[model samples]
Target: MGRLFMLDVPENTSIVDVARHLDDVTVGRIGPYMVIESGDSVSIDRRSTDVRHAVWYSCVAGIEGWRIAQWDKDALRTEPR
Candidate 1:
């Protein structure tokens, strides 16, 4: 499984929304974090979220059971650690 904990902030709202719509993904909350989990990889297309560079780069609050396999202008992909 892969888990991404995004900070619950205004700038990150779009990202969280996109994540919630992904296949086989689940979105939940833990305090100030939006927890996104999936059995396989968790990938979010940057353009889909409509976030600018600064907000996109700073959106990830934390992660677990996974590592960032890809993070660029195109997308953010996390795979099992």
Candidate 2:
């Protein structure tokens, strides 16, 4: 399984939206944190999220059972660990 945890702020809401839009991905919440889960992997495009640079760079609050495949100003891609 792959998972990413993020702070549930206004700027981060789009992250959850992106995760939920992906096939087979689940979106959950732990207090103020948004948890994104997938049986495979999770990849969220920064552009699609429409967040500014600060939010984009700091959106990932935690990662579990996954590795960052790519993270630039363009996108964030993760793979099963």
Candidate 3:
């Protein structure tokens, strides 16, 4: 499985929510960051979250061992490095 990390900001709450909806994905917190774990690909729809541009762009604080495969106005995808 791969891990994805996100900052614990108001705009990132939806990220956690969206992550929870996915199967095999677990959401948790580490310090000020939200950690997501998945057995396969992890994806979150940008429009569904309704996060502002600035927040969406900077929501990811750390990668752990993962890299951003797709991150834009459409969605966020993280894969193992």
Candidate 4:
């Protein structure tokens, strides 16, 4: 499985919601990190989250076992490293 880490903040809540909607993806917390895990690539739509540009751009705090496949105004995609 691949993992993505997002910092716990008001603006990042939607990211968690989006991650939860993916098949085989699970969302959990480690300290202040919102850990998202999945067997395949994971993606989240920026517009669906409704977060402002600043928050959306800085939402991803770290990555574990994954690399950024795509990250833009439209979406964020992470794949296995």
- Report the number of the highest-TM-score candidate: 1
lDDT measured at residue 18 in model 3 versus the true structure, 0 to 100: 83
- What C-alpha lDDT values do all the predictions have? 0.92, 0.88, 0.84, 0.88
Candidate 2 clash pair list: none
Error of 1 at 39 (Å): 1.0
Report how far residue 48 has shifted in candidate 1, in Å: 0.7
Scored by lDDT, the top model is: 1
Candidate 2 segments whose C-alpha is farther than 4 A from its true place: none
Clashing pairs in 4: none
Top-down TM-score ranking: 1, 4, 2, 3
lDDT, candidate 4, 18-60, per-residue tens: 8899899999989989999888999899999888889988988
- lDDT of model 3 at residue 59? 86
lDDT accuracy of residue 58 in candidate 1:
90
Candidate 3 residue runs with Cα over 4 Å from true position: none
Worst 10 residues of 3 by lDDT: 59-68
TM-score versus the correct structure, for each prediction: 0.96, 0.93, 0.88, 0.94
Q: Write the per-residue lDDT of candidate 2 for residues 1-81, one digit (tens) a residue.
A: 877999888889987898799999999988888999998867788888888989889889998999999989988989987
What lDDT score goes with residue 61 in model 4?
A: 85
Q: Residue 56, candidate 1: how far off, in angstroms? A: 0.5
- Each candidate's clash count: 0, 0, 0, 0
Looking at candidate 3, what is the lDDT of residue 70?
98
